[model samples]
Target: MRNVMILLLGLALCFLAACGANESTQGNNGSGEVEGQDEAEPAQNDLDYPQKPISMIVPFSAGGGTDATARALAAASEPYLGESIGIVNTTGGGGAVGMSEGINSTPDGHTITMVTVELTTLPHLGLAQFTYEDFKPVAQINFDPNVIAVPADSPYETIEDLVKDAKDNPGAIRVSNSGTGSIWHIAAASVEQATGAEFSHVPFEGSAPAITAALGNNVEAVSASPPEILSYVESGDLRPLAVLAEERSDALPDTPTFAELGIDATIVGCPRGIMVPKDTPDEIVEFLEEAFMKGAQEAEFVEYMETNGLGLVVGNAEEFGEVLAESHNFFAELIPQMDLN
Candidate 1:
């Protein structure tokens, strides 16, 4: 009887030891820690993305078309993103300064930049060292077709009349653009290319200033978007001669397009979009694309765009990337021909 009791006690002790070992192993695995050691923290991927507010850098001064677009987009996207998107303008170097800041930001998808058509031309003009390839496109929000406008009292009644004057007086008629390498400037260059005329090109800091200069009669005409001069056109302060688009704009349907006039000037406009660092995770990029796309389709956003005379051109990351590549290639070929380089 004594031998039997001793054997039973030994068996009970073994069972207890097994239970303790099992518990210890489970605790170590669950807490990711060993006995008498600290626990390991979770990995970065385990955390929610956009854990903080996003910063959207606009490489232009306030009140410009790009700034307006950025504000509109940020306002619209904040609801969908569940966080605020702050717009920070770091102007200078014809967008180079802000662009560099955006490009050099941490690639964690928290910082993005509002890119314009200038991304395709600035590098070719020796004004920037980076191109569209340097950033990963997130979404394309708006596109505004360039319009040729003159002061309401100008003698030129039609686009043909303006072209005739330009040809007759080469480098005499002064034409103003937003900046030397801006999309507005490219529009003027396209006009010069198609009509084989030479007009003295003047550069301003932005579209607002360029249009103001034209309204004040400082320049013979202004190459800018219809929206930029909408108030002036409505108030009889400016007369729009032509729209450099393949089709007429809804905002200014009465204005003729360069295509209808047999001019081969197409694709002269500003395309506004968002871009992030190229190394951002695909999942994060996808999330942003979906969120921004939803924001773009929101009714308030559409109304704002229409009211402001800006066209809503929404595209996801892949589509935007394709557009960027095409624009870059087009400029790469056209810049040399226009001697802009």
Candidate 2:
């Protein structure tokens, strides 16, 4: 009898202990927090998007300005990305081959392409199969503004006077550009559109030759980058009348923007920005945009740009995307009339 009673008591105690354990396991403190359970995890992929070294594709030669600036930007962005950035020069077909490689790359944050004005131009010219819409813009780091200059001894002292003369003598004033359908050519076209003038566009092999033609009076005026014509202006060879940019060029502080002169020169020149494949996740895209925009403001990048006379204009993803969209639309409409088939 006593043994039976003991067994019954032991079983009862075991049941009680199990009940207590169940209650404890399901219990919560007064703070409403559960006991002995792990908290929910965070959204992890964004924090760890770039899990390896990043490849930056520059669609130009290694020793050129694009490659140099791209390398500088990559070096500046490394600290923010927590991964080293490698610059790869993929040159062919005037930026088509390299850009194609980049846009067709894996849609991860590891591959970044440094895009230029050619992104919009090449497509319209039938030079490239892909358009700006194929990629997501991260940020713009540079904008080489176009400057309109005449020979020092020319009668047109101001941009207004230059336009008036061109309007008076339609097709008489020859304007030189880098080449047909080039960004500088677009700049010259912008000049004619803004002022309602007709210019005889003489496309040279490149900006140097175009500027040389202006210097030697082969053309009445030239549209080119600020750096290309700075020495000539300093030497009193070319007289800068206006700049086709959102603001005046640092190299020619005295020259006014087309906007400042009541003309809207909407064409952009040699704007360099970072981009990823369009299929890249939005989270990764945002993360990269933050990194590159931060890097563009770094002291190293700014100093390098200033020393090299490269134009430094930084903007976030939204702004850069807007620029690409605007340029794309403008070129789409304008190229049909350019007769570049």
Candidate 3:
């Protein structure tokens, strides 16, 4: 009986030791740090870039203006990047889904997203959980100017004519855009503030569908990127009313700008840029910037811009980041006034 009791005591001691070890390990894991283990992994940025295929996420759906822009940019950048560049479309929640994916991506520089004016407006509108600070800007591709377009047979010939009708009809004039707080939507808002005109706002899935609605005469007007409406304008299905830039578009040289039309605000084109998670290595970001800056000037790229009716305003990472900051600040102020929540 004495020997059995001693054995039981020994077994109890061993069980206590095992339980203590498990509890200690659970505590360490919950704390997310191992004792004496370094969390910061050293990585050099200037190393040979694109050791593998790069992935670019386009937040908008395929066949839209943003997706087209992504394809052209990917094509232009692949040779310089020294790897196959793959475009992944992850669209939902008015582009917030793909943006969330971008913000949560690994910081190895292998993955990034093409961000548009939505980058500025999403957080301001409370549609996005992450803000511009969550990203590290890589490079800016171009500015996609918003152009006002109407059906070819519409009575309104110019921007002034449209504004006159809007003023008289109040909310009778129907205008279509991709979504609330999108660049096109903001352009319409700017027009309203400038002219004190009112119109019924119609939101669509993306610019293509919005342009299609305008083409089908479901909406009186559409505010979309030049590429979205260019083909129809060329085919005489739509009439170009005005370009939102300070200057006219090269694609439509005869068109007038909003500034020329005496609008107080310049809607100008929203710039599209590339961004990675905020914690990405500086070297990887620099590598991508260098590649895109050079690739942006290629003749094929210029042809792509012309073919798509987009303006290429290529800039390096720092300049792009500055532009992004300015846009973020601008939308942060503008959204509140428009009551875009």
Cα error, residue 192 of model 3, in Å, equals 0.9
Instruction: Report the C-alpha lDDT of model 3 over 175-268, residue by residue, as the tens digit.
Output: 9987776878878887887788897889776787788899899999998877777788889999999887666777777778787777765353
Q: Give RMSD (Å) of candidate 2 vs. truth.
A: 21.7
Candidate 3 deviant stretches above 4 angstroms: 1-51, 339-341
- Candidate 2: list runs displaced more than 4 Å: 1-53, 60-68, 89-94, 149-180, 193-222, 227-241, 245-247, 256-270, 306-311, 334-341
For each candidate, what TM-score against the reference?
0.82, 0.63, 0.81
Better of 1 and 2 by TM-score: 1
- Total clashes for model 2: 0
Q: Please, what are the lDDT tens digits per residue for candidate 1 over residues 1-341?
A: 22112112222122223322443211233232334322222123432887899999998777777888889888877876777899998777667788888888999989999988888878878889998888999987776778999999999999999999999988888888777787778778888887887888888767777788888999999988878888788999999999877668777889998888888763556767899988888888887876686666555666777788776666667766876776777677777777331
Backbone clashes, each candidate? 0, 0, 1
- Reference-based lDDT, each prediction: 0.75, 0.73, 0.74
Model 3 scores a TM of 0.81
In the range 1-341, model 2's lDDT, one tens digit per residue, is 22112112222122223322333222333344434433222223445667889999987656444676798898877877878899987866667788899999999889999987778887888778999889998887776767889999999899999899899999899988766666777778877866788898987645666788999999999987776777788899999998876556677889988877878655456777899999998889888886776676666666776666666666677767776777677678776764331
The true-structure Cα RMSD of candidate 3 reads: 20.9
